[model samples]
Target: MRELSFHGVTVRFGAGRSALAAVDGVDLTVPAGSVVGLVGESGSGKSTLAKAAVGLVPTTDGEIRLDGAPLRARRDRRRLQMVFQDPYASLDPRMTIGASIAEAVPGRPGRTGRAAEVARLLELVDLDPSRAGSLPSGLSGGQRQRVALARALAAEPDVVLADEITSALDVSVQGSVLNLVRDLRRQLGLTMLFISHNLAVVRYVSDVIAVMYLGRIVEAGPAAEVLTSPRHPYTRTLLDAAPRFGVALDDPVPADSELLDDEPPSPHDPPPGCRFHRRCPIGPLTVPERTVCVEKDPQPAAADRPHRAACHFASDAAPASLEVPAR
Candidate 1:
């Protein structure tokens, strides 16, 4: 059912001495019309993967495939769109929001249909097309973010990679934008890779969730299952970090009670075994899953059938700790 796939994808940067691996070999499948959430703390390589998917960063290794065809082979730039975290920064200051959105469209056809598309986008994100002429500086944070979404839509891409699209806005304003994306997903039958560090945000919009730690997906499953019953220590740490009204998920208070704090190891000097073992709380792993699980990486293991976690004790590992009351 997944339409997008990643095969052993890896991305490194800098020269020989300064080279750093940002996203290590990561394999994933994203279903069409499904919102797959990618969550991790800052520098966890979540953004890097998103950038790599859109070819923003040259891959150090691995391959990306869309619709069963190789994505790395072709330069079908318009087929996939990217919406970055900082809406204000991603947009152009000189261009009207309309022109910004229209730019993604190409040729005379794009020029003509641009008006109707803009109107539809405004309604989709709850913005007035009349504001198309407004500058990014004039718009509120939320409005500017919505404009970013509208611009990405202009391409009519089959898949949209949204990296922390809401982190830059007020909490209240975030809900509306998320709902709009969900609504657009239904209307367009799109395949979205919605990346966010906030588990709560990912839970709200994603159909499936992939928990990323140090550039690897340690746990993945239905949003509810992973959120309610995670099997990976890192996943537990993430869920515990979320602030639910009644639940006590409270992640171990950070140094300053920062919640989650394990500076990702330098990819160039990643730990010999298990890049996450340094921060992971669970002790289960498969020989191959952890083949290098200790000094190697693990593969996603089936837990509750379709649900998966990459741990040797996938079958028996206790669910990650959370503050939510057991219902």
Candidate 2:
């Protein structure tokens, strides 16, 4: 298992004043053999970061490292593969599933060897090997996703970047896909960076959770700690917004904990200081001391700390009401 690290990674689109920093100075690490969940709302740059990792998008600055070395060569890039959100769009409609998977297998293995490998991969994803002969159009949405995973694994990559792999599936089938992800991680010791906006889904599959907002990670920690005791106001708001069963309609919302309904600032010209201060429930809008959040940018926690939040008041205790139930 090789580690994937993003050191001050920045991905900008366009040029001059109109440029948009889709992924800005993101410093994150997916530890060897572990799954790190990247969670945030739409337009938070989650997909851009994942795309940059696989060379789909260019980085304006910073470096992406695999196993402690800069990842630049095309050969080295094959070690990292991606499973995108839309199964139908990602797969070739004309190619049989077997042929698609076979195409990813490195080195020109003989026809017999490639066929056997494709069957093995299909079975690994719990798909019938016989279905490999069928085109993607012949499969259901969930089945096509499984085939996509099979193709990524066909490359024998050390790390997989799964970008909202379940969001496009039916809610009923989402659980099965998520379960498959957990099973594959365990069975193959797969290192992954799973991106999603659904906190509940992220909580279910992630060992660690990193919360992104306006192109920067605001909070990250062990899943249990971040979910149960979120430090950033944005993180807390996300948890509160998630659907909770069995809670009475009259259940009191925590004081000063409601997220502002306004849309987030544009990435093309993000606000100075803390980008989230305008929407932060506990920020300058509510707390006087939090004025610093508007005057200065809060840096991430020291590298030695395992659980960190990039906020001046990160040490402040979260409300008990913010705790989410364990899956």
Worst 10 residues of 1 by lDDT: 251-260
lDDT of each: 0.74, 0.87
| Model 2: number of backbone collisions | 0
Q: Candidate 1, which segments miss by more than 4 Å at Cα?
A: 15-17, 110-112, 248-262, 283-308, 320-327
Range of the 10 consecutive residues with the lowest summed lDDT in candidate 2: 318-327
**How many times do residue backbones clash in model 1?**
19
Instruction: Give per-residue lDDT, candidate 2, residue 121.
Output: 96
Residue-level error in angstroms, candidate 2, position 60: 1.1
Question: Compared with the true structure, what per-residue lDDT tens digits does model 1 show for residues 1-327?
Answer: 237878889888887878877777787888887889999878878888888788788888988888877785445645778998899899999988888887776555555588877777877778998997788899998899888888887777878999888998898989988888888888888799999889889998898999887677778888888877777666776666677686555334211122235476766776755566655543322122434457544553433423466655555555532222222
